[model samples]
Target: MQIATMYFKDRAQLKLQDELLQYNLNKSKGKFVGKRAEAIRELDDFEATRDAAKSIRQRVLDNLDTWLEIFEENARARGTTVLWAETPDEVNRHVLDIAARHGLKKAIKSKSMVSEESALDHAIEAAGMKVVETDLGEYILQINDYEPPSHIIAPALHKSKEEVSALFAKVHGTAPKTGIQELCAEARAVLREHYLTGDLGITGANFLIAETGSVFLVTNEGNATLCTTLPKVHVAITGIEKVVPTLEEASTLLRLLTRSATGQSITNYVDILTGIKGAGEFHGAEHMYVILVDSGRSKVLASEVKEALRCIRCGACMNHCPVYQNIGGHSYGWVYPGPIGSVITPMFIGQEVAADLPNASTLCGSCASVCPVRIPLPELLRKHRETQVRLDLRPVGERLGLRLWTWLASRPALYAWATRLGVRVMKWLGGYEGRIHSLPLASGWTNGRDLPAPAGKTFRELYAARRRAGRQT
Candidate 1:
């Protein structure tokens, strides 16, 4: 089965997701708490910064058309070729066209969620080019022979350090060790070789600056620089939402992004690579191509759900979300997960395919509170659910139950009768304990929960009793 299909349809994916969630809860025990506290402490003006970033993003979105045009003009002036792709197929063809033109055999890749979304690796490999993932996380995932990334910031956050060591040991023929320094050294040595031998480099931009037409890439390791500098051809794949109005605005967003994400005042490296440094510099991607993919951003921009595009992919919502902290990213089974995933996945894959994603959230408003852009994620998720219900995507049993509830709620007599019946049933089932240990229709819930018996008197009865007592007094 296709990865998309397997992700959406297979029950094992859900089960695996559950297992992975439990695993993460255990692994992130102390580190997660520490990071969260650090985030709160490090950013003294978090709210102000977040507000500033939100205001800047809103202004950029309002003038996206103007900014994009300005960005294109600047990028071209910088001696870089820019390509626009309306669809994933177009994007694949464009990249493959470039590869064929250059007779590219091997391509080195930095971590790119856009490329993952477009399935670029598969396309390049099919076009007779070998693509190597250079980021330590990406390389480990690639070698373990697995699926695309689950998290936006930390692609392999689901996998523990030990799991990574095992993957390295398996791919490099060494015994898995628990030492992170040794494992990182091994990965660096292996990825350096790929970087030195690569013919083309592909990367994703954290932000595309309209003022300077510069792509800002933030990374913990220097892999992004290596990817762009080593190969003779550099290709950047990114969504249209990545565009910002100015370098200053992008930097402001970056300040909040890294801090909210991992509580770092700054990332390990922040580089702004313009066009070729020199005419004869055969080192970098001799021809730098930036593929701005619209895939569905234009439609998103035109809809009420457009606020979702405001996301900067910081993963703060996921880190703070009670649901995400419990279930992790894999459960959603998409490129983006957590609350943002719930709101946008359906739009990307269609409502029918991602119907369950919206229901995944608890609507506790935690996502909205933590969102740096204030995307109103819970509201958007509620909207997805309402849309699903309108389209009859709800299960028959659930729909029928809701209809039955509505019908009873509309008729006071019928509602009272049902309440009395429910009270009698519960009282009989509970005996002297006043709690039902098992229920026929809800045995799963009752298996671990005790249902308290209803009060002998209804609300109306209690009210009448109170009135009589007052009159007697």
Candidate 2:
């Protein structure tokens, strides 16, 4: 789904009015945040492990091209077809070409944000094949006519249980079950046939191991395992940053992924695939293809914010962000959202297209605190702002005002006098209530809350007054 045409300010204001959406966002993030904290507290060495994960990811990025070639060669040795795509158009074309050559009609898919970024499902459907999301959360979003995934790990975290029930009933022509188990069963029954008979199965890789030529898939649901084995041909899609030098390093990152994502020490399933079925394999796909999509990732790795690549898709940062908690994910208007999305959207896409995204934070550092990779998200966002200023992308009035403030801040005596004078002006505008209900250039900030009036005196004035009192005493 496309982002709303309204600017970020208007979009966020409108989203805050949606009581249902707010309820879902709060409830979902609260659960994730609480669980993540507990899981981390239980593990004494999570921070040390995070350091190891960071070091491993850094090493991979240091020689990304070398490791990628190593992975491709090893994967080829095991009879896997590896395709390197430099752009979204190239990636989609490659997948469609494979589908058309094989004459595949239907496919079962697990959740893949990389696929979402490439708009792969839309491309496949445009090519005239039925594609179904087997993961229950993704299944909900797909059937809802591509309602954007609101959360990274929990796509349907923005929808209430009742909402899911109603949506399923409407789409599947069956009564919605009240219980979670029954609900899953209902979805399972509906998707089982498609999983068994689809011409191809598509999934995403969590980590590509170069040493073993294996792609790892981690999920709570068993659907990924099915997608890896059920169909005659299986396709695994992931970003170029997913490759690591060895399996042991991949394992270390896996420990952090689940704990930071869902609060569990480990997820329900972890599947490692070396290649297609061999001569005597009883259960496996006959052919396997792994697509490494560079769609803006190569550029990201080369930029100042290369550390963003250390992200394991854990979703911890999003879960703790106050801004994301209030406005939800769709407001970001892209495949990724929250803190990481804010950083990457401008870099991957144009800074002008998602210009306001970097400004959508409180700079509270909640995201950084929760991040397992030690990325300085607030600093990266500040850099984006600096780039915007350098490009003169901000409004002319905003630029002039900032310049004036900078000039005033440089002179100490003038600054003290100006702040005191500003306090008087503010007190006049704010009235005896001591709160500003409205203000120039910031109506949005005070729309639902009040800004406190400035103190009557600046710190320098207060200190001077105290000094005079002490001398008289």
Candidate 3:
């Protein structure tokens, strides 16, 4: 897929509107509302579980270096080869090297966000290899010429069923008038063939257990299992932050992840261990490689923003965020979206490229409330904005105007003069109706509305008159 970076604040509101409408439509069609409500209500201590998950993740972040070393030891013991890449180019090169060594031509992949971050689809395609996405959401994105995924779980969430039908017809050599069910059936048949014939598979791990070198994959459609097991060579790409200290810790986070994401007590399938198959093995990859990509995660961890590392990608924040619900994920114009994206995108991509994302929020705290790991999402976004302003990445007009306002605010006489001048100008703009349908300085505030004119009397004048009236009394 062609991945594009965007300044979130610049495009946030419009994106949010799209996401909100999309979520509402999805809810109407998918029973998401009732399902989530029932699942939330059924848990005796959902809040407690959320807290437990947060605490465990906090400890992991605090001891990340120690846990990573331990995880490496354990994974190697299980006969899995672990490779670390410090950059996207390095990760891509490493994966390509593996495929080249195996002489792989066809590969299957499960849903992995880290792969999305690395632009793996385009990378592999550029290498003259055919890679197929096995997860339904990912498959939709893959067939659509690798448009960036709109939602973490449901990549085609922004697309209506009609649109999907059209895409399927165009891609699968089906008739344009094909029915939705028929299109879906055709896709399933086609993907099953890839599963059988693919020479390599790639997947993303939900959790990496340091004690056993085991990566846990959670999925509903069992596509991950096929992507990992059916191919002769399997390659898994994941962010470094995915590691936990032990299998027990991984299980705890996994428990919270499923319920928080889709309201499932457990995903339909969770693959707990991975490595090369041995002699007489009925299923599993013959060659397994786990690529740990740092990207910008290490830099983020080194900073005070390490709390963001606690994220398990449950996507609860995006699901509940008002802005994300409205705009959907495309507006963020990055791999991760919603509140989490707002904080992490700037860190990874650079503040200048992502200044708009931080300002996109109303700081309503909805994301923080629903975050499975208790990440202070809103506060962190605000912090990003403050940093952006200090870095002079904020709009030039706003910055200059604020500097002038600060000067006026410090001098009462100048402030009073400016206030009177402002009233005179506003009175002129008010015209006969005592309102400005539109104003130059505040056009964005009144694009589809009107700005009320200031009252005739100034507060200073009114205060003096009131004092005189009291004396007379």
Candidate 4:
């Protein structure tokens, strides 16, 4: 909720020192990365499918206005109220207004990143309405002082079974359970009551099908199904970029979405909700609403980083990111985290406040390699760094260091001489062990491990010596 992006360095340092958090992050990385690789390997044509998904996303962005209008028209025809909100406050206002109009007392919610972006739960509680999170992971967070989600797909990835058992024991006033199934059962028992009594259901759409005027919901837990169908009124909120031209396109993307997100060939529940309950229908919402949230998406669409808009929120990039693997998600201090977060967080929030986020990456390119839609994550991060320098958002020392390096890079002789001198100085510092354990300017790197000293000669010197030997031979 709060934009603590400016204190990223401090938070990251604290997270690094947290042993339990590090263990959880490491365990999750192994599960997510290994399963995703296996899932992709089983695909008949993974690259081709990725290409198609990218094309669909780009097409939608290029004609977003037309597709949005078409979606709105079709959704309205199906008796769904379509509302547009340009900001998070507006989104909360719309949800509150709907609740007031319907006299809805209890709201059941599935996991929605867009809603998290809006802090909708806080808004609803402030409005004197009872809001309950139905997703198991979300419920864990809801009771734990409303801690923010650590990962997009697995929100409570940072929490271990022991921690959750303790939390549930305290919150539910029940005996502590160490088994995962028991923990889940406890959560289910608590959430089932809310599901039955809740008058309002709020969810996020995985894909908004323009042709059929349907909102696609994908989940492994089956909670989203109940959230959308059981309540008297259902409200689905998602970014406008989620709209696709047809169910066929949505289907194509779904293949990538499930696998990339949780390594499932298909989720347990996939609901294509069109509108309110029909005359004869018994198991559907009486009233349905779709809120298309802009919230700086238009700015992202028009900016150089528009490729980020193609993100399906599968979170594969974050799953595979080395930086995220180490620091975890909360370090980003926003709804989204990891590589995609580094790119778009600055876009949604101002660059002035979120300038440090873009630098959170190591530019390793692993994120791009695993991205289902082929977003150039490394390039986008570099673009953000460039923007930071241009805006003078970086520290003066960093800017000056880059400038000095650039000036030296332009002069070949001076660059070579400087490298030779630098190597000799490093060799002296390394002493007989040839390991630089501490350095004046690079303590960040040296604080953890030793940096190997440079070899006796620079690359150019070695190359010239080899050429001379060849000529003599």
Candidate 5:
């Protein structure tokens, strides 16, 4: 919600020292990675599906305006109002105006990252209306003073069951329960009332079908179904990039989304909602509205990072990221986290504020390998880094260091001499243990762990000796 990217280094240091957060993150890392591997192993056409999903997203980005107009026409034809907002502020204003026009009071929400991007809950509460979160994870966050989500797919993944038990006990004024089922029951009992009585329901669409003018809602808890069906008015807020050309395309993307996100063949519930309640329909919203928020996405579409628009928010990149695994998502200090966050946060916010995000990665390529849509996350991050350097956004020391490296790198003989001298110096510093425990200028690396010393000889020396031996032989 707030741009705390400037405090990333500080927040990351704090998260690193938090043992409870580390334990929770470690527990989740294996579950998500293992499940996704098993799910991929079971699917014979997983690669093909990934390619199709990438193609589908690229097609939409290439012709976003045309597809958006088609979606609006089709959606409006089905008695749904499609509203466009250029910014997050505009998105909030539109939602507030809708609430005023409909005379709606109590609003129930399912998990919507776009809503988080817009800070919709705060806006609704400030407007003097009650907004309740129905998704269990979101409801937990709402009760906990609305702490931001740690992970996109599993918002409260940072919280252990014991922690949640205590939280529920404190917030609900009930006896503490340790068992998962009991805790869920308590939450359901509390949320069921809000679901039934709320006049306005808000959700985020996983995918939008342009052909059918339908919003595709995918969830494990089925709360989205209730949010859409039980309320007098339904509002779905999502990015403009979510629209697909047809259900067939959406179906292909869905296959990849579920597997990549949670390693499930499918979620517990999938709803293709079209417009309002029909004449014979027993339960549905009287008013259906879809708000497509651009909110810097168009700028991203025009920039070098346009490939990021293909993100299905499956969070495979984040789940597999080593940086995210250790520090958790809150360290990124933005709505999105992990590898994708590193790319897009700077694009959405300015590089001046979020420049450190791009440099957060180790460039290990794990994120790119596991990404369902095959987004070159590492390359995108490098692009951000290049932009930062071009704009002189990096600190003075970093820029000077890069310039020194560049100067040496341009001269082959000097670079070779420098490498040899550097290796020997490092070897001496390593002493008997062959580990550099401390370094003068590189405290960032040594503070966390010791760096292995280089060997006595450089790679060029080793290669030259090998060539000479072969010639003698």
Candidate 6:
């Protein structure tokens, strides 16, 4: 399938008119915001947690190679095989090779954004193995036949309860008009069988502990535990940056992450699995495997947008962002979406592929305010704009306008005269309404909302007038 990240403008335009999308977007974010607000009020040390997470991430990045090496050695010692994947294709090849070697006919998976980024599900299906998504939202998307995830956390937030009921009946052979719990039960009944019988299981790590070679998995539905335990061959695909120094650091991050992402003080199911199940253990995969995927993350680590790596994939920024609240995640056109995606997508996917992303923001700073790790998202977005200008990727009209503005601003006399003349022209154009319904060469801004005409005088002129009046008094 063609990735949509390159066509953000087109996707956003279509998304704006989608009544279903708007309803879900508003409902989903509103619910999360309420929960998060309450959670934040209860946590007195939330700021400290953010600081700790930020510091921990900074340390990890500074010694990233050391930490990854340590993690590899410890994991190997625990009887777990670690695969290093430098790119998406390499990740697919490694996963396919594993499946081929095992002769796995079917696989079940939990929600894993890294896997999405690698498109591993499609690759495995192309290799002739069925992969079932165990998470409720993901299961909905999967059974719907190849629909992409629209959000970082909630895959099917775009779906309504009624729509889900209809889909469940159509796909799962369930009774019609199922309630939410009934639908969940139906999915669980089917997924339980997949868990018991699947040849392989794949999952993503919330945090990879370098100390004991543990993969931390968090989920609300408790399916990740099944994904890890029920299948005899378990595979974890995660970015190299997921590695943390210790379980303690992981815990601190988890506290902030859950609260910020879903407004929960703690997620219901937080599992920390290390190594294969020992001889005395009742269950767990005999052969444990983890694929540490670089997948252009190394380039991000090497770039000015390295602060984006501090993200724990909490999804808070997306939930709080006004742009995302209206247009929804699919409009961002990538695996990751919203503020975080806008900052790093260009760097990961390239400036050319996601050129419209930086311009998609209002620079409101809401995302940064809600982010648990405190990545300066607006500043990073500004950097992306600078990158676009440096690369000369902007349209000729926008470039020329910016150049003209710069020229006028550099000349104080010209700027003052021009502002006065422009104000008069706008007032005349607005007539009695004092609002601009249309403007030459700037219809995009004026098309929807009325643009108030400029005040009679500039700020500089007003300030100067106040100064003269005060001196005379």
TM-scores of all candidate predictions against the true structure: 0.92, 0.96, 0.90, 0.96, 0.95, 0.96
lDDT of 3 at 188: 88
Q: After superposition, how far is residue 269 of candidate 1 from its true place, in Å?
A: 0.8
Report model 6's TM-score to 2 decimal places. 0.96
lDDT of 5: 0.93
Better of 1 and 2 by lDDT: 2
| Per-residue lDDT of model 2, residues 189-237, tens digit only | 9899888788788999999999878989999989999988988888999
CA displacement after TM-score superposition, residue 384 of candidate 5 (Å): 0.5
Output the lDDT of residue 349, model 6. Answer: 71
Model 1 C-alpha lDDT per residue in residues 131-217, reported as the tens digit of each score: 998887788778877556667787777787877887778879988878989988988888888888998888999888888877789
> In candidate 3, what residue range of length 10 has the lowest lDDT sum?
28-37
lDDT score, candidate 6, position 241? 93
Which has the higher lDDT value, candidate number 3 or candidate number 4? 4
The alpha-carbon RMSD values of the candidates against the true structure, listed in the order shown, are 2.5, 1.7, 3.0, 1.7, 2.1, 1.9
Clashes of 2: 0
C-alpha lDDT of candidate 4 relative to the true structure: 0.93
lDDT of 4 by residue, 1-473 (tens): 77888888999999999999999999999999999989988889999999999999999999999999999999999999999999999999999999999999999999999999889999999999999999888989999989999899899999999999999889899999989999888888888889999999999999999997899999888999999988999999999999999999999999999999999998999999998899998888999999999999999999889999899999999999988999999999999999999999999988998888888777999999989999999999999999888888999989899899999999999999999999989988888999999987999889899999987579999999999999999
lDDT of 2 at 340: 95
Q: Positional deviation of 63 in candidate 1, in angstroms?
A: 3.0
Window of ten residues with lowest summed lDDT in model 1: 1-10
Put down candidate 6 lDDT per residue, 223-275, tens digits, no spaces.
Answer: 99998998888999999999999999998898888888888889999988899
lDDT assessment of candidate 6: 0.89
